[model samples]
Target: MISPVIPEDSRFESDPDEVLGDNHGLPAGWEVVPPDPADRFTVARLTHLLRAHERQGRGWAGSGVDDVLVEVSEHGLRTRENVVVRDPEGEIRAWGSVHDRSVGRMLFVHIVERGLDDDVAARCSDVLVEWAVGQAQAVGAARGLETQQIDTGAFQDDERQHAWLAGAGFERVRTWWQMTRPVTPEEAALAESPDHWEKDGVVFRLVRRSGSGLPDEDDLREVHEVLEGAFVDHFNSSEETFEEFLHRLREDPGHRWDHWWLAELTDGDAPQPVGALIGTVSESSSGPDGSYVSYLGVLEAARGRGVAKGLLATIISDAATRGRDRVGLEVDADSPTGAAGLYTSMGWTTKYVTESWHRDVRVSPA
Candidate 1:
């Protein structure tokens, strides 16, 4: 039987006694250990590695310090496990993280130092992926699942990453278009239509928040239900509990209550939620901040009623009002719902492409 990685509750404090996964199959001079959330130097090194990885893979770095910190932070560790590799001289060279995103699904991050000898880099990748397989089995057993899917991503043009993932038994499953649209100050008028948009008997508006700045619980649930229903037949749809949904979204560094919106059909006696859109702030170190559409879902019944368009318009107008320079989103390149066509028609262009790689690990019966 495999033991799952125990979660740490202490925040911003070193846990020298924490038990980490074994360093199997690594090079002779390298060691793997759990990352200390309290260590600024370690965090800095991980951030540097992430930036370098992005630049090498995509020709530009988009992640900020906070973005990298959120993954290893105390709050994030509740459902995630991470390890950093150190060279013979104690310099960090690679970082690996695994998140129990949902039942039967594990998210993997494999990052190794750029410009290393090809053989050494390949060895590091093998070690990280081997550790991830153990983690997938452990988490699957803990969740009472017979099998778990390990999902990881790589940039479209990143042949090195593709090769590493392929060597680890992961197959390219899907492609995503990372699209961006420039926002102008004048676009703020997009929201002048009304506080609530009504078309074809459907109403769209932002989720209601209380005076204390917390979103209404009932409305939040409605949004969650709508999204869960909307994606029921979509690719890789997983059943995530409401509590898990709220917790995971809050763990994001850019989560904002006002960035959530819901669409409802009022033709009936009472309004019923049919769509939801969740946006986040994308902080830029070199330019103005942007808005990211983290999620956009419209139920099949509300497909042709323009609910998605209205929700997107709301976010674009909100970004303009907040003086954000652009809006960014990722769309499935092969979506049957024609989502990519809608985005392209709305002025979004593919800035880059990303691919999803997946491997299924079978758990032993307990």
Candidate 2:
């Protein structure tokens, strides 16, 4: 089915009177506008709105509006145009978007705006939710959509935003603890090279993408397989296809091949990678003032050997060499693997706690 088109003149206004006039107590007249790939300003506005609400009392250090724009416009995942609720004067009071549909059945939506005031925000939220449900229904009717999920998470410190998500019928499903370690000259001096670390005859190696060093097809496939096996049972875990994983990473502005590390077993006649950590350093204006670890994982068979620690040390050392002031990563608070303890032992401390909320969708006969 063709997606609904939102007109240009109605971009970002959600005056209460106009909303009331459209349908009295019920939400109506909301429009979803697809952003032109070249429209940087609209994207900037959406990021600004999200940051304003999401970054409260948290370190906003590594975030950039440009980074978000690049992800939305250049990333391989498909993005619907901005959904906006406007007033008669064409002012946007609320806006959001959905991205990365899978099997044309599951779609994820994130709300970027709600009215600034409590009552108005409530009205705006109701309208936005209605529109979202409608959109999901349309997709399901046309393409056999089965489930729709909306992510309404913000930095850990944003109590108001968290409350709003709960009020909107979403249940907290997970928590990603953002942790950081300050980089000091003394710490650097104390930092030992991970080169001397080995586990069960396995040696660690840092991989850098040269103009000529992109991983061969075999290595790429191995990396994908390793990550899938590593986190298959972790919290909120779900299988992500190789293309989906690659698309998500490529969409990020901070992604770099040099940031990845592999642990290879050298005891045999031929060397083979047994564990890997995929991470990217992101710069933001909030938090510890430098590079953030987007993700890190090790294969199950490779655990208990110093592979995980070696990989982390490699990233930390890399950060120091690059003159980064600090390094950060997120860990599931309830990780079954004791990963959080390992991070704490490495000198990282919890900066804040962010929670996830979920609502299972049930279709009702109309």
Q: Pick the candidate with the highest lDDT.
A: 1
- In order, the Cα lDDT scores of the candidates are 0.84, 0.60
- Candidate 1 residues lying further than 4 Å off, grouped into runs, are 1-23, 193-195
For candidate 1, report its TM-score. Answer: 0.93
Model 2 C-alpha lDDT per residue in residues 253-363, reported as the tens digit of each score: 778766666677787799777777776766655443366677677777767877777777767766776677788888899777899999999999998877766654554
**TM-score of each candidate structure, all chains considered together:** 0.93, 0.78
Task: Name the runs in model 2 displaced over 4 angstroms.
Answer: 1-32, 57-62, 74-81, 101-115, 134-145, 185-200, 208-213, 284-289, 363-366
Q: Output the worst ten-in-a-row residue range by lDDT, candidate 1.
A: 10-19
Number of colliding residue pairs in each model: 0, 21
Candidate 1 residues 1-366, lDDT tens each?
112333343211122123234545567878877888789998899999999999999999877678777788876777887888788999999998888887778899999999998888898888778778877877787778899999999999999999999978999999999999999999887865424666677777888878877788888888889999999998898998887788788878889888888888898899989999999999877789999999999999888988888888888988998999899999999889899999999999999999999999998676
